[model samples]
Structure formats: C-alpha cells, structure tokens
Target: MNHHDPLLEQLNQLISEGRNPDTLHIDTASTLDIVTAINTEDHKVAPAVAACLPDIARAVDYIADALQNGGRLIYTGAGTSGRLGILDAVECRPTFSVPDTLVVGVIAGGKTAIEHAVEGAEDDHGQGALDLADIRLSAHDVVVGLSASGRTPYVTGALAYARQTGCKTIGVACSPNTPVLQAADVAICPLVGPEALTGSTRMKSGTAQKLVLNMLSTATMIKQGKTYQNLMVDVNATNHKLKARARRIVMQATDCDEATATDALQQADQQAKLAILLVLTGLDVESARTLLSQQNGYLRHALKAHC
Candidate 1:
C-alpha cells in the first residue's frame, strides 16, 4: 500500500468536491441575494444534525448512566478534534461545576499538541494506550473518540483500550464507514456530508462534533442534579466573578433578596451548591451540609429532603 497514494487521492477528491467560496456570485447584488445563499448553506447544518438526534441522544443516555455510577468521561482525539475535546472538558467546570477530574481529555501529542501540531502524533497507537493508562481508566468510565475520517489511530486505540477494560466507549466521526465507529460501543456518525473544503472536517464536521459534545455533557450534568429547575445550582465560586454568579444563582433559585442570598452563600462558606440548598430549604448551614452529605452532594435532593 502506497502511503502517499491514499493521501494524494484523498487530496484530489477534496479539491474536486469542495465548494469554492470564491466562485460564489456574491457581489453588490441586493444584500438579500447574498444573505439568501449564505442562509441556505447554514440551514443545512441543523437538518444534518437533526437527522441524527436519535443516535446522539442514545449516546448521551449511555454516558449519563455510566457517570451516575461514578464513571468519568474521557475524550480522545488529534488536532482539531483534540482541541474540541479539551474545550468541552474545560467548560464543564464553569458551566456545571464539575470537578476537573470528572472529565479528562487526551490529546494525541499531550499538552504541547494543543498549541503546535506534533508530527505523526496521530499515528501512534501505543501512545494512546499509554495516555489512557496514565489517567487510570476504570470500568466506570466512558471514553469518547473523535475523528473526522473515523480512522485516527490514536483515538481508535484509546477507544479499544477503554472497551477492553469494560468501560463504555463512543466514537464520533463525520464520515461514513469509519473503523472507529465499529470499534466503539456506541457510534455517533453525524452525516454532515462532505466538507465545503473537501476533507477539512474542521468545517461542518467540527461544528457537528461540538454540538453533539455540548448535548452530551450538558444533558449528563442536568441528569446528575447539577441544575435546579433550569438554573445552574452547582456553580463554583472560586473567583470574585464566580462569587457574584453564585449569589445570583441562589437568588434566582430561591427567590430570595440579594442580602439573603449573600448571607446564605457566606453561611455555606462560598459553596454555591450548598448555599442554594440552604436558601431553598431555609436550613442553617450545618443542616444544609448534613442533608447534602446524605444526598450525594446533590442540592435538589438535599432540598427535597429538608423542605
């Protein structure tokens, strides 16, 4: 098999099938005409994702089940895929108050790769195994592999390793007939079709992956009682900005005045989840703390018991 041959052919097909934004006849025609064409193309993305909502939902439910049992969520990818994984994990803390250890992202070339591409890092299957080992993957974890081509060696290896260890694994790819999908327990193939830039999955494919990951992580957090009636009840007030948000969240959830919210937050020692619980149940800090400890740190559960 000629290593260069596949790449050359793929490149040629890419150029042939790619949409030439330059060829678009978007001149000084009425602004309406220009807007129409752009809108038409953008509209295609949602329908593409809509067609696969069932599959995406299935993957999310699977992940939620694992996480309920103390499982972690891990993402594996290379380059743009890796960056997206990291992005999702990082956002969990601020968005849902998840601990950093709950969501792990394994990039192909490690931390250095996030900034600069590491040559041939994607091809290293052994490295993928090593990274998973370092993270101490267990059967209670879920591994998600992201690859546009559905064939990145590193991601495939990580998914394979995770499955072997009795952990649930998911593969998300833009293209059809990807090997990574076949290896994973749940395969999410968002048929965004070919990219406008041909093989550049970072275009439509990347957007689809981002949407799916958002749904997965957000839905999981909600399922775990991190939210209280659509409000973020588990916010971490680690900084001044977050402390302000914590007070606001408490106020919103309990319909308390700003002073009362501030008092609750202070009583809970700046722990937003506990503060919300205390305000909602009208419990003192010690009672709220005991209720939360009994309810697995879920503010909603603690509130239900106390109130």
Candidate 2:
C-alpha cells in the first residue's frame, strides 16, 4: 500500500471505517448470534436516516424541480453505492411509467464496474466528471452522488463537475462532514456510525445509502404525481404481472369489480390512473386523457377539476 496516499488518512477519519465495539465477538459467535448482532446494528439505520429527513426532503425538492422542468435525475457512484443507484433508477421506469432517459445511473468504470470491480476506478476522480460529461449533463439535470464513506473520489468529482455545470447536486453518504457532503448543493449524510465488520461499508453504510436513495427517489416521484394517494397510479403495465397489477390498482382506486377494472384498463390502454378516471367519472377515453393532461398527469387533481 502507498504510505503517502491521502485517502488513507481520509479513510482513517471516517466514522464508517471505525470498528464496532458491539460486534467484536461476532467472529466467534454462533451463526444465529452473529446474525442477531448484525440485526441490532441494522436497526440503527432507520433512525439515522430519520435524523436527516430534512436534508433528504430538500434533495427531493431539487430533483422534483428538475424533473418538472424537463430535466433528468442522474445518480453517480461506485461499488455497492453505484449498484443501489442503478437499482433505484431501473425501478422508476416500471413503477412510475417513466422513460429510460429520465432517471439515469452512472457507475464508475462504466458498465463493467456494475458487475466486476474495476481496479482504481473509484479513485479516478477525473473519470467521474468525464462520465457525467459523456452523458451530456446539463444545468437542468440533478446529479446525486452516493458514497458510503462520504469521501469516494469519483463521487466527489462528479458532484464538483455537476456544481460547475449549474446542475442541482445532492450528496448521499453515511458519514458526516466529508467531501461527498461538502461538494454538493444539498448534503444528506445519515450517520450510520461504524460498520459491523469495520471498513466493510457494504453493511450499515450500504443500508443507509439504500434507505436514503429510496426516500430521495420515492418522495420526488410522489411529488411529481406518480402516485394517487398510496397507489402507484402511473405504474407501467409492461409485463404480464405488471398488467395484472395495473388492473388491480384501478379496481382499488375506484372500488370496482375485476371485470369493470379490466374493461376500463383496456379502454385506457392499461394505464391505471386513466382507467380509474374512466371508471369513476364515466368519461370517454379522450375526455379522461384530456383532463389528466390538463392536470399534468395528477389523477386526483384531474378528478377534482372535473368534479
């Protein structure tokens, strides 16, 4: 190892890298006991995230504003952090009926890094910015940088470049007062403390990142009218299972029978929100679609406006 590496010093100061006093005996503990110990630490994740709800909500506002203005939401990270971002981005399409280009994920080392560890990828800060540039990042986009340790060079670099481009930037990390947090317009650092295995951020840090990303994306989509009450009104019926779900959602939204929901779904081309509007308002497809369009796809708003 290079003794002069600055990251070494930086990592040494990170709370995510410190050993857990509570899990010291985890190595020799029974399997159940080991898992129990892990579970105990896992329980700490939610409250930590709860403490940062303000900043997380603020980040959501930035993302929602960007999306409303026709900009995209982009997440950049490395390792476990990167994979989590990709998971969230991919889910948005099926869950909210969004296009592929709307929510984007960029992992360090490009596509290969998503599956295999690309040596020195996260350390290449310049590549982080380059990756954003390659994606044609604009001021209208929101770039969210995810890093468990809160000091991943790649994430920090991406945040810096995003800021320079006048892009709305958000940093999600598990440690407090680190570069990842410092580089962005909004800092959402949920201090999940030390990992159970010490320096293995894939545990608590990964959990924290997932939780924060969940809120960041889910809340933003909700604000953008992807949901009607608690139902996924905008869900895309892209597959057999999703098609069934879309029908069920319409039924639940309008309290109609399966046949009625199915009929409306067919009329609305399997769009759950539109199907609900058709079922409840007894409107033709064209009128229901026009109302939804007038309300910017907000189902409840469209219903209220028509009523």
Candidate 3:
C-alpha cells in the first residue's frame, strides 16, 4: 500500500471513477454497440438530475431573491465545469435581456482557461477566493460552485469565501459526501454513476451539471418575471433572428395577425413585452410602458392593472 497515494484513495471512493461493469467489453464492441452502450448510460442523467429537483428549486429561490435585491448570480468552477458556467452566464443576457454583469462566471485560471486547460489552477484554493474578491462579490449576491468530484479546492475555496462574505452559496456536483456539499448552503448532487470511459466526468457528469444549471437560471429568471406566459418576453432583439423571434412572440401572446404584430412592435419600439401589452390591453405605447414600469416589467401584473 502506497501511503503517499492519497489521490488514488480518494478516486477509489468516488463512484464516478469506478469502472462500468456493463461496458467492460466496450473496447471489443462494434460501433453501433458502443453507441448503444453510451446511450444507455446517457439515459440515466435526467433521472439522476430529477432526484435533486427539490434542492435545485431551493437554489433558484435563493438566486431570484438575490437578484430582486439588486444582487448578482455568479458561478465558479474549473475545466469543463468552468466552461459550462461561462456558457450559461453569457446566454442570460440575450435570452432574458439582463445585463451581462448580472450573471458572472469565474473560472479557475481566467479567460485563457476557457479554451485551454490551466495546469494546477484548480489546486490553488486561495486563487478561487481571490477571483471572487476581484469581482467585488457582495453579501447580496449568490455563488454557485461547480465540481463533478465536489472536492475541487478552487470551488471549495470560492464557496468558503462566499459564506464569509454573507453571500448565499450553492454547490453542484456529480458525487455525494464532498467538501463542496458540506460548504455550500445548498448542495445539488446528481449521481450518474461511473462513466463509460471511467473517470471522464465530462460525459454524464457534465450533462447533469448543465441540466441543473439550465433549471437554476431559467427558473430564477421566470420567478423574476423575465417570462410572460412561457414566452421570453424579455428577450433582447439585437440580431435578425432575435428580432424575428420578438415579432413571433408578440403574435403568439396577443393572437394577433402578423400586420398587427408588426405595427404594435414598431409602435412599442420593438420591445416584445410592450408590443404584446399594446395589442392585448388596447393601450397606447406610453400607457403600456407606464403600467409595465409600475409592475417592474411583469407583463401579467401590468395587464391585470389595466383590466
């Protein structure tokens, strides 16, 4: 027994690192068989994530509360986890019309790490705290730490610092009984079991994390009134595709013809929510805008006020 092999011992205890008995013969399998095996393993991800829905819902409430109080939602992780955080954060701006700063992503080794692996970056726990500090993380904000193993020093450090600063912390991982789970105020673990290729968490683990993240951000945005009756009313119509989407949303929300939708959108300055309001409430752009402002952009509330 090698007493110095602590990492080996740690890996041994992780179900994610264990070999999949079902795929033991994958190396000798045909192409179709290999894909079938991977597909079978992939099917477990959704149910595993479903098991953590209660915790995910709790995190979403915390996140929405933080944002409502003029706070931000920040995510921190390493490698694939880090990339996922960045991806989600960037998408929020265009999807919900929120400022980019409202959703921040902090990786272990900075921007370059998003494209290439930064050797030893995850091991520097202190750097994680520093990264959050550098961004001026505040007590009202929420920090979500992502780590498949749930023991990445970088994520643990960030969560610890977030707690000290009075920020709400949530940990997302693929394994249980981890340091991150213990550190965070809420822990979301999706135990997808061993990978088809042993220890490659970027497979099932990554998928699980992405699904949870989707729920966290989308649900929080919904709670904050970013959506109007399942439509992304707050969408930023910056590009051609988005502008087309905005028109379609107005038509859908109001059940109006394309010409009416187009006229409403133009009168409302191309704002989908305002266009929908104008069509549904039969109000001029200014009155619709005023009601929307009073309701803090909640279209349903504004509609109710007019009705």
Candidate 4:
C-alpha cells in the first residue's frame, strides 16, 4: 500500500514536525554536544507551558466545578498523550483521597493500548465517541483532550461528543491553531516549537503536556480544599510512607510533637485533616469532623471559624 497521503504531508507541515536547524548536525556531533542541543530545546518547554497558564487556570476551574458537583474529570488522548492522561488520573486518587471514578483516562485503543500501540486507533473517530459513552459521560462532567499535533481524530471526536452531551471541554495541544483547540471550549496550546529530532513529540511536547496535566489536577484539587496550607491534608494513608507523611502533615499543620500528632491521628480515625483540626482547635473528634464538614474540608476555613 502506498503510504503517501496528502493529509500526512500537510500534517508534516505542522511546527511539531519541522526539523530543528540546531540539531541538523547532531548525528556527527559529540555526545555532550547532542545533549546540549537537546537541553537547549527542552528549556523552551516551561515558558511554552507558562504562556498557556490562563487556559490552564480555566481548565482547573472547570474541573473543580465538575468534581464538586459529583461529576468526573475525564482525559482522552492517544499515544504518549494518552499515557500522560492515565498517569494524572491514577495519581489523583492517592494524592487527593479521591475515588478512581472521580477522574478518568480514556486512551484511543482501551486498556491494552497502554503498553502496546493499537494500529490506527488514533484514527478511529467513532471509537473515540464510543469510549466516552462507555464511561457514561454526563453533562456535569469535564472532558480534556490531549493531542500533541492538535488534530488527533480520536480526541477531536471525543471533544465533539462531549460538547453534544453538554460536557465542558478543554484541549491541550503543543502546536498552534489545530482542530483540538477549535473543538474545545478552552484551548491550551503550548507552542514548544519543533522537536529536536524532527517529529518526535514525545520529548518536548510530552513534557509540556505532563506539566499542564500537573497544573490541571493539582490546582483543581487545591481549589477543592484537598490541601491545607500546602500540605496534603486529604492524603490517603494507604501505605507506610503515606502514613508517615500524614502524621508529619498533622505535626506541621498544628506545630504539635510527633507523639501528639500520632495520638490525634489515631483519635481522629486516621484522618489527617480531622487530626489537624482536632489538634489546632482543641476540639473533640466529633466537633472537629463537624467543623471540617461545615467548611467542606477546608482546614484553613475550619480553623478560622473555630480559632
């Protein structure tokens, strides 16, 4: 089969596909020279992400609203972008003590696609809509589409279906002026320029996408009162390390000794935020729980009310 499609050629015209003049001679350069060239390109990723802060902030607000209303935040993409979405979704549960259903990741080819490439999966627009449908996406949800090229048919289809279903949509893309952006209610385009090795977007573009996902999840959780003064107050102490961290969080929040913090955590039924409230406000476990509940788990707000 002849693989020379005009659309592919047009896609190659995208900035992500443009070859970097700086790395043209990398093949003949020393190892240090190649590293330096790639490092120079990598330096552009942060500022590119910084340029899209407004869009990212908008996304965070949208996600926080959806989550607060009992709706899930869904991320859809293909390839490296898909993996990044899943990475962010999986981390949210342990990091913020949220349920897995609250944040979801839908890759183009399903769970099997996480480890192996599913041929032509990204090209299947209908499957994209089907994937979201399978999740029972609703009007209260927010769907974020991740596409390095900004034209993945899978993501574009998801965004369209999400809009049709009255779900809010956000698009994160590395290239400027693409379909994913047009399909989304809010577009976050981090123009990281071309890859050091031509069309390899998994490097710089992947880094930018990861950064945006970090901001989206972290900021949304912060808005939801998951953190208490920069500490992971809602952290799930499901493991030894996390339990230690939870204890430390209580200690840090109330300036209490380790023994007192540990005792408070135990008295509060191993709940970090409640323990902190108990220690800081000198309230019983039930009163601390009530105050935290009244403030929607915002430690600072609960502290202000009792202190």
Candidate 5:
C-alpha cells in the first residue's frame, strides 16, 4: 500500500515541456502591444475551458443537486488556486444570493493568506485534513480541490479527506493525468498547455482555473433557480448599487416600466425573483412569496405552478 502518486512525474514533464506563456517580450513596444499580446493569451482561456465544458457541466449538475439537498460547496486550494476558489465562493453571495455558509472557501493558510502568502502552507497535508475536519464535512457537501499542477499536497490531502468523509469531491486541474483527479469523485482538467512563464502556473493555468471556477459556480446557481431565462434572479440587494441592479433585472425580466417594477419590488421586499413573479403573474406579495417558496425559489417553476 503505497501513497506514491504518478501526478508528480507528470508535473515534472509539464515543467520540462518548455510551454512558458509569460515571457512576453514587449521591449520598446507600445503599451497597447503588450496589452494586445496579453489579451491574445487570455483569449485562449475560453477555448480551453470550452473543451472541458461537458465535464464542467457535469460537475455543476452534481453540485446543484447536492446544494438543493442542503449541501455545502467547499473550495480548497493554495496560492493562486486558493485565491480563485475564494473569489468564486465570495462572489456567489452578491451575484446569486447564495448564503455564506452555502458556498465556503478554505485556503491553505486561512483568510489572511488571501492578500499575502503564508510560508510553506501549501505543503501541509495535515493542515488540509484538519481544515476539512474542522468543517464537519458530510455526505451532502461538495468539495472542489483546485491546483494547476494537480499534485499540490494540500489540495490532494483535502480531496482525500473529503472522499473518506463521504463527501462528493471534485478536482479541477490544468495538467492531464493529475493524481488529484484520482482522489476525487469527479475530475475536471482543462489542459491549457503550458504557462508562458516557466513553471508559473499562475499564467495560463490560472486563467484556465478561473474560467472553470466561473462556470462551476454560475452554472450551479443557474440550476438552483438563481437565474431565470439568462437573467440573474437571486441577486442580493445589499447596497444601493445592487438594489438598483435588482430593480433593473426585475424590470427587464418582467417587461414592466420602472414605476411598476419599483412598486412590485417594494411589495416583494426587494426580493428579485419574487418581484419578477409578482409582476409577471399579477400576484400579490404574499401569494408570490408562497409560490416562490413552493417552487423552492425557482421562478420559472413557480410561474408554471401559478399559471
């Protein structure tokens, strides 16, 4: 029974592949030239992500089902990987009305490392297990382990621990044949070739991970009824800016004028989906709220039920 992983060998191959994308030679070139080159490289991210869309969608579907059944979406990673996971988790609250506890982010060095790296944190496999254990993981939870190299000790440890605890574990990596994938239930690897900079996974690899993270979180929200007809319906109006956006979203979705949308939004206590439901179905706030509840916040389903 050996824990030796083949991913480490593949990682060495990746390093030796000479696929650096970060060595942008912009000497004496216009600022726009540098920008254009960077943009061109960035453009490659989508296609890489597109190639793995099926896997991503599958992960999204599974995550949604788990979340619908009262599961948590937990992201685990280190360094750039950790930052991307944290960003995805935090954005869900403001973007899709997901509760903080519903989408949780756990970096290797904790929250403090979000801005500054903590020395040797990524090497702590024990810390990964401790983090998952501290969360009291359950079968309903979905753990996403992120690592560009796909062999990050911290990420592997987290996924391994999650699997042992009966949680649905997902591995998102940039390299092919990553051991992190083997340790998880679902694996999504977007092979983005090599970074422009030697051994700098933060280059193209980071972009690839970000794109996948965006898809995973956004698609899952769409499945959970946070979106209606390509419109974000679960946006949290936490501030004036968001409140205005919420009003605009409802107006656009319901095809109502500003005054009517504002009135309906107020009637629904600024709940975007409920407000849209009220406007579209001509139901009062209480009835609209009830229908939304009945449909589990799925506006489209509630509309079908009401209509």
Candidate 6:
C-alpha cells in the first residue's frame, strides 16, 4: 500500500470525506440522539445552498438564454450526482410540457447505472467526453457537471468537452476550488461541509446538488413561459391528479367555476393556459390558442393583449 498516493491525499483533503465531530459520539448514543445529530447537520444544507444563489442565478440565465434560442440543457454526472441529474431532467417533460430532448441526463455508466451501481464508471475520464459526443452536443447547448466530490473525472471530462464545443458549462459540487468547479464557465459550489457519516457524499453533498438542480430546471422553465400566475400552466396532465390540478389551475387563473373550468379545458384540449384564456377572454379555442402562440405562450401576455 502506498502511503503518499495522490488519490489517498485527495480523499484525505476533501471536507466531505472528513469525519463529523458532531456525530463522533453517535456510536454510543441512543437512536433518538443519532437522528437528532443527523437532523442538525441537515439544517445546514439550505443556508449553504443560499450562499450560492448569485452563482446559481447566473447559471440559470445562461441555461434559459440558450434554451430560448433553441438549445438544450444537458446534465452529466456519476453515481448519486448522476442520478440526481436524471431525476431533474426526466421531470421537465411532465412538469412544464417540455420535450425530453430539451433536457437530457447523461450518466457515467449509461442507463444501466441509474438503478444499479456501475463500478469504475466514474473513474473513466474519457468515457464522459464520449457520452456527450454521442449525443451530438452543439454550441447552443449548456452542459452542467454534477460531482459532489468536486474532482470526479467523469464530470470534469464532460465539462471539458462542453467547453470545447463552445457550450456554456456549469459545475455543481459541494467542495470549493476543485477541478469540477474550475472547469465550468459558471461554477456553483455550495459548501455543505462534511457529512454526518464520513465520506458519504450521498448525504449532505447530494442534498445540496438536488437543491441546485431543482433551481436550475425550475427557474429555466419559468423563464420559458411555462407558468401563469404561479401555476404550472404548461403542466402535462397525464393522469387523474394532474388533470384535476390543471382544472384547478384554470379556475384559479380565471376565477371561474369548476364546471366552467372543466368546459374550457375540454374545449381547449386540456391545455391549462389555453383553458384559462378561453374562460377569461371568452375566445374560442382556436382563437385563444392563436393568442397564446402570438404571445410566445406566455399566459400573462396573452391575457393582457385581450384586455
């Protein structure tokens, strides 16, 4: 065993890999005490995320501008980071009625890695570059690299490839000044400190990344006219719950009765934004839809035009 190995040194230097002094006595404490310690540490995650708001906002602007101009938002990572990226990407379709192609998630070991661990997948730096290349990455795309460790080869490689393609790159990690952050055009590092369980980035670091990813996708969608009056106007009502929600959104947006909302939604092909416009403006479905399209799908703008 080599004592001065660089990998060993790197791990030793990582704050995420360091033991938590707050939880040092957990082994001998009661279960309640142990959970309390974990809870205390979890409370620190939000403020850490809040500290990176400026950087996160900058990343959002880059992603939103690129997407508005016919670009995609690409998330690439390994392990837990990769899984979080995929979760955020898959959600955009149903949440905002956006095409899946508009937001893609590239995991280190491919789709198989999502449900099961793929050993050595994150260690291959070149594979990350290849995965983005396979997707036909374009200059208009914005690539976000997720790596809690801040030094994952897979994330760094993807960011490097994105930069090479002249795409805007955003790096998200929980550690400061690491390769993943440095490689990004817009770096968002939320220092959540060491985990309650030593070296388990799946905990605090993962939570921070999840928060940031949520902001990135949600804010970008809002900027893209996917919402109306704080409602998910473009929400894909594929099931009963969302269908009910869509009707409710129409009612809320137009202050119409439930029956009126249902009728407008039926006439407007279940599009909440269109339904709301029909109820508020008394325009026919086609006319309301034309108005929405003219306003770039912004319900507020469409409503103002009718006024």
| lDDT per residue as tens, model 2, 278-305 | 9989999999999999999998899999
At residue 180, candidate 2 shows an lDDT of 90
Report the backbone clash tally of model 2: 0
Deviation from native of the Cα of residue 304 in model 6, angstroms? 1.3
Q: Which candidate gets the maximum lDDT versus the true structure?
A: 3
C-alpha lDDT of all candidate models, in order? 0.81, 0.92, 0.95, 0.93, 0.85, 0.93
Higher-scoring candidate on TM-score, 1 or 4: 4
* Model 6 agreement with the true structure over 34-143: per-residue lDDT tens digits: 89998999999999999999999999999999999999999999999999999999999999999999999999999999999999999999999999999999999999
Cα deviation at 229, candidate 4, in Å, is: 1.0
lDDT of 3 by residue, 113-184 (tens): 999999999999999999999999999999999999998999999999999999999999988999988999
Task: Give all TM-scores, in the order shown.
Answer: 0.87, 0.97, 0.98, 0.97, 0.91, 0.98
Candidate 3 has an lDDT of: 0.95
Output the lDDT of residue 171, model 3.
Answer: 96
Stretches off by above 4 angstroms in model 3 are none
Show the lowest summed lDDT stretch of 10 residues, model 1.
Answer: 14-23
Model 4, span 204-253: residue lDDT tens: 99999999999999999999999988999999998899999999999998
Show how many residue pairs clash in every candidate, following the order shown.
0, 0, 0, 0, 7, 0
Write down the worst ten-residue block by lDDT for model 2. 1-10
Q: Where does candidate 6 clash, by residue pair?
A: none
lDDT of 5 by residue, 1-307 (tens): 8686775555567632445545446455688886776676667778878888888878888899899899999999999999999999999999998778999999999988999999999989989989989988888999999988887889999998898888888999877777787887788887766554556778778988888898889888888888999988888898999999999999899888999889988888888888999888888788888888989888899989987
Ranking by TM-score: 3, 6, 2, 4, 5, 1
User: How does model 3 score by TM-score?
Assistant: 0.98
